[model samples]
Target: MTPDTTAPTLALLLVDLQNAYFEAPALAGVRESLIERANELVRAARAAGRPVVLVRTEHARDRSTWTINMRADGEGFAFRGTEQAAYVSTLERAGAIDVVKTRDDAFHGTRLREVLSGLGVSQLLIGGVSTHSCVAETAMAAFAHDYRVAIAGEAVASENGSLAAAMLDFLTEELRQPVLDHAASLRLLQGPLDAR
Candidate 1:
C-alpha cells in the first residue's frame, strides 16, 4: 500500500475590501497596504488557476436587512446601492465569484460554503479587512466547516490593531492554523496548500 495524496484544492478568500471600511478616516492608514497585500494574493491565485472568492458585506436601505447595532444606531453603511458596498477600485476582482454577507461570519447567511464546496475548495488562503470581526469570524467558520485555513497577516486590517493581533494569535495558536506573510502566501499558492 502507498500513501495517497489528494490534489490541492485551495481558494483565495478576500473579504470586506470595500469602500465602507477603507473610506473611513480612522482606517485610511491601513487601506493602501492592506489592499496591496491582498491583491498580491489575488494575482497569485489567478496565475495559479485557483478560484478567488469575494466576500463582501451589504445591507438594504429599508432597515429590513440591518443588523441590531445598525438598527440601534439608526444608520447603516454599505447599503446595496451605495458606493460603500462596492469593492475598491484597486482590488483584483475580475472573474471572481462574489458572495454577499450581512453578518460578520461570511458563511452564516451566505452561499459562501456552498460556493467553496462547488468549487471543490478544501483549503482557504484568506485576506481582507477588519481582522477582528469579519476576517476572524469567517476563519472560525471555515475551521468549523473543516476547511484548512491560512491568513495573510499584512492583508488583514482592523480598526483596533490589538484586537487584530489577538485574533491572529488565536487562529494561529489555538486553532492550529497558519498566519502567513505576503511572500509565503504567494508561495503557498504556487506550490502546496500546506506550504509555509
Candidate 2:
C-alpha cells in the first residue's frame, strides 16, 4: 500500500535526557549508549529537516512549581538556571526546539503540544531517560491528544530496569503504541513524512 497522505508529519520527541537523569549509577551505565542513539536520531531528523524537540524537566528554585514529592521531601531537582536542568551536553541539539517542563507529563504545563502542532507534527518518535516517569507520562499524554506515538526502546534508560520494562509493556500492549528499537526508529524518522 501507498503512504497515508492524511497522516501528519513525524517529529522526534526526546524527554528528560538531561544530566541529572544520568547521574544515578543504575542509569549511568546506559548513558553513553542512549546519547549515541539520541544523537543519531537528532542528526537524522536534522538532515531530513524534521522537527526535533528536546524536552527537559525544570523546576523553580523556590519550590514554587515543585510537585508534591519535592515539597514533602523539601528538595528539588532540575532547578532553573542549574546544570541539572540542562540537557545532556553530548546530544545533538543545535537546531532542535526546547520544551521545559516541571511535571512528569511534558504537556502538563508546557507548550509541548502547541509546539508540535505548529510544526505540523502528529506522529512522534520518542526516546528519553527514566522510562517509568517522564517518558511514560509524556507518551500517554501525547496519545490522549490524538498524536500517534512510538518509543525507541533502546534509546531510553531507567533507574529501575523492571519498571522500565513494565512501562514499555503498558505502552505497547495496553495503549497500543509501538515500542521500537533503534534501527526501526531511524527508519521511521527517515521515511516519508506521511508514511505510517
Candidate 3:
C-alpha cells in the first residue's frame, strides 16, 4: 500500500547531513548528489512555507555520551562544538530549526516532535545519510508517532548501494511507505497540504 499523502500540514526532516558523515570514504561517491537533492527539497519547503528541520548527531567530547559499542570502538563521534560535527557547508541552513541528537532516532531526547507539533506538521518528508541506520530509525519512529512519513529516494544515501537498496525495499515494499524522488518530493511538499 502507498502512504496516505493527505495531511493538513507537513515538514521536511533532514537527518545527519553533517561534515563528519559526508567525509567518510564510503559516502564520497554519492555525497555531492545527495546534498544537491537535499538542497532542492529545502528550497521547495521554503517556497511552500513549510518548516525544514536539520537534525545532527553530537555527543560529549569525553565520549561519555557515546553508545557502548561506539565507545568501545574508541572512535570519537560528532562531538559538540567541533568542526567535524558542523553541518556540511553546501546545504542551506538559514531559518531551519536545528536539532542536536545523541542517538540514531531524531525523536529520541530531542525537540523534533515539539517543533513539528508547533508547526502543525502531521506529515514529514525525510532524507539524509546512512540509509540503513539513522534514516531508517527515524522513519520507523515517525510512523509509530502517527505522523505520515515519506522518504525522499534520491536525497538519502548510504555507505553502500546494497544497504541503501535494502532499506528502500523494506520501507517501500514491506512497510508500504512512499519513497519519492527529489522532483516528486518537491511537488508533494510545495503543493497545497489541505487533506483530500
Encode model 3's per-residue lDDT on 17-136: one tens digit a residue. 998897878787778888888998999999888889999999997877788788889887788888879998898999999998988899999988887777777888999988988999
- Extract clashing residue pairs from model 2: none
Name the top TM-score candidate: 2
**Residue pairs clashing, model 3:** none
Q: lDDT by residue for model 2 over 1-196, one digit each (tens)?
A: 3433453489899999888888899888888888999999988888777889999988888889999999999988888889988888898889889999889999998988778767678789988988999899899999999989999888888998888889999999987889998889888888876744
Alpha-carbon lDDT, every model: 0.85, 0.87, 0.85
Q: How does each model score on TM-score?
A: 0.92, 0.93, 0.91
Quickly count the clashes in candidate 1.
0
lDDT digits (tens) for residues 100-164 of candidate 1: 99999999888898787777678898888888999999999999999999997778888888998
Q: Candidate 2's C-alpha lDDT?
A: 0.87
State the weakest 10-residue window (summed lDDT) of model 2.
1-10
Task: Estimate candidate 3's alpha-carbon lDDT, on a 0 to 1 scale.
Answer: 0.85
Candidate 1 RMSD to the correct structure: 3.9
